[model samples]
Target: MTRSRAGGGQKKIPTALNATYYAQRASAGLMITEATQVSSLSTAYPNTPGIFTSEQTTGWKLVTDAVHQQGGRIFLQLWHAGRVAHPLWHPEAATPVGPSAIAAQGQTFTPQGMQPYVTPRALEIAEIIEIVHQFRQGAENALLAGFDGVEIHGAFGYIIDQFLQDNANQRTDRHGGSLENRTRFLLEVVEAVTQVWGAQRVGIKLSPSNTYNGMADSNPVETFSYAIEALNSFDLAYVHLMETSEADLRHGGHKIPTSLFRPIYKGTLIVNGGYTKETATAALAENNADLVSFGNLFVANPDLPDRFRFNAPLNQPDSSTFYAAPCDDSTENCGFEKGYTDYSFFSQLEASSRAE
Candidate 1:
């Protein structure tokens, strides 16, 4: 859910528009902000927000304060794009860094336009340890920004996903070639972040059946089973799991459902992927998951929980406006409200009907 409207700059500070958008959706049980870069080199797209700098942390405080005014809880998602990032976003680095030197087979949105993925420099062991520290710093920054917690972005073919999947990680080092080795980076990051926020306020996202950014595992079940079971050692807030999408299946991904890991995971499990009220209720009723999360549904329906309560119609999402709109002037605001904060609430629609 990267709206990509934080505005372009070295800081990539969250704008007032971001505060308004999240505040409007404050009705969600728990609001998780868009994937936020943990460091300068962690960016893969233009205008995504960051948590590393003082200015960015201050900007996020606006969002947290606004949401808290409405009695809402929020978590900042910490992300590192890794090989998915292009040189356009990280000119200081030689190239994007990953577990191995291989490049993902896809393109990423950049300031220049969509560019083909590039081969990344394999990270040294010391560099990997530094990245773990970066995640720790991000968790600390989240607390400073007034977030209720922080969710590590280990899903969606990012740096952690690149290490977890074998196709993207061909190294024979301790970071690759085995389930334990591949998951080491993720565990270290989790451990580091937990030290800052403690296990109860930290969560990790995993997409075992994900096929985006050329991600695939030789054995997803075994890989994720070990990862989920290992998480039992920590009393985390929740483990967010994504169901395999149609796009994943089209890309030859294994049909490893999130339910497969429910039994293995020893804590609260949150399942996501195109869930409606009915399916979400069924999931909770059948004990398939402890909780269910909505992404796209919440995008166009800011008062989504109320809509579910009243069985109201939903506002259709405009995919074109899902991300930041192009602006001729780089310095001007790009109308982020068109498909964002402008989404009408259920009460507004009912009032409109009464007036008509």
Candidate 2:
């Protein structure tokens, strides 16, 4: 979940509010920070954090230190927004780059306002290689920032997904066409990042049936099957799989369940997508997944693990404040803490009831 509170600048440094937010949720078995840009060109939305600069790295150090003090493990999610990014946010107004020149059929939040995505410049082979290096450098920076590990953001119709899915990638070059060719960029990035963090400290996320950002594949089962099997070669920390959502179905996406890939993947599998405590427990009991990740639930219930242990009621997330918005006199507790760090813990609720 992108909190979008990193304050505007070329550096996009994480603020103390970010440290407070993650530290509050340090009870989770593992905490993966919001999608962080690998470079300036990776900008997709205003106020999102980046890990490319020295200042940004130092800022993340605050977050890591806070989490570690609470005995938590955190992984930085490295991201490149690719064509989903707009020139309005780029330095000198550079066009967004992708595997092909096609533009996604949607608009993205920009400084000017919500703007339709522009046709991106097709990345040359040399440029693709450079982006791989950028991921590697981001991994090294994560180490400097004192993160437990790094997860490559290969899912969610981003740069790597742009290459993996045919709808966004129409190139006739070696980088397109077959499944092997399309997966080349993802593999190269994984290889490069693993060189820095080693396989045990790295993970990759994949959303096979995701249709967000206008992404679709003619044969998602085959494409992702091969990708997951190939990952067996690397003893990565885990392969995070997102189940197809209602939004994906409404967009005409194929229903490729995580169960379909469970047998194919050889290592740790972390399943996500609208999971409740019952469903997550059932998944583990049935050996469907090694772990289950929560997004919205964690956002609202900072002490989620304790809530689950006690089978207590949860705090529902306020969708309007899911992402950060501009502060104004009309909005109370605006900027970072409204729907963020202010979510009460189960212990607090218990104390309140006792007082009453």
All candidates' TM-scores? Answer: 0.95, 0.95
The number of clashing residue pairs in model 1 is: 0
lDDT of 1 by residue, 239-264 (tens): 99999999999999978889999889
- Residue 156, candidate 1: alpha-carbon lDDT: 86
Tell how far residue 90 is off in model 1, in angstroms. 1.8
Using lDDT as the measure, the top candidate is 2
- Report the poorest 10 consecutive residues by lDDT, candidate 1: 324-333
lDDT of each: 0.88, 0.90
> Using alpha carbons, what is the TM-score of model 2?
0.95
- Where in model 1 is the C-alpha error above 4 Å? 326-332, 348-356
Look at candidate 2 and tell me the lDDT of residue 239.
98
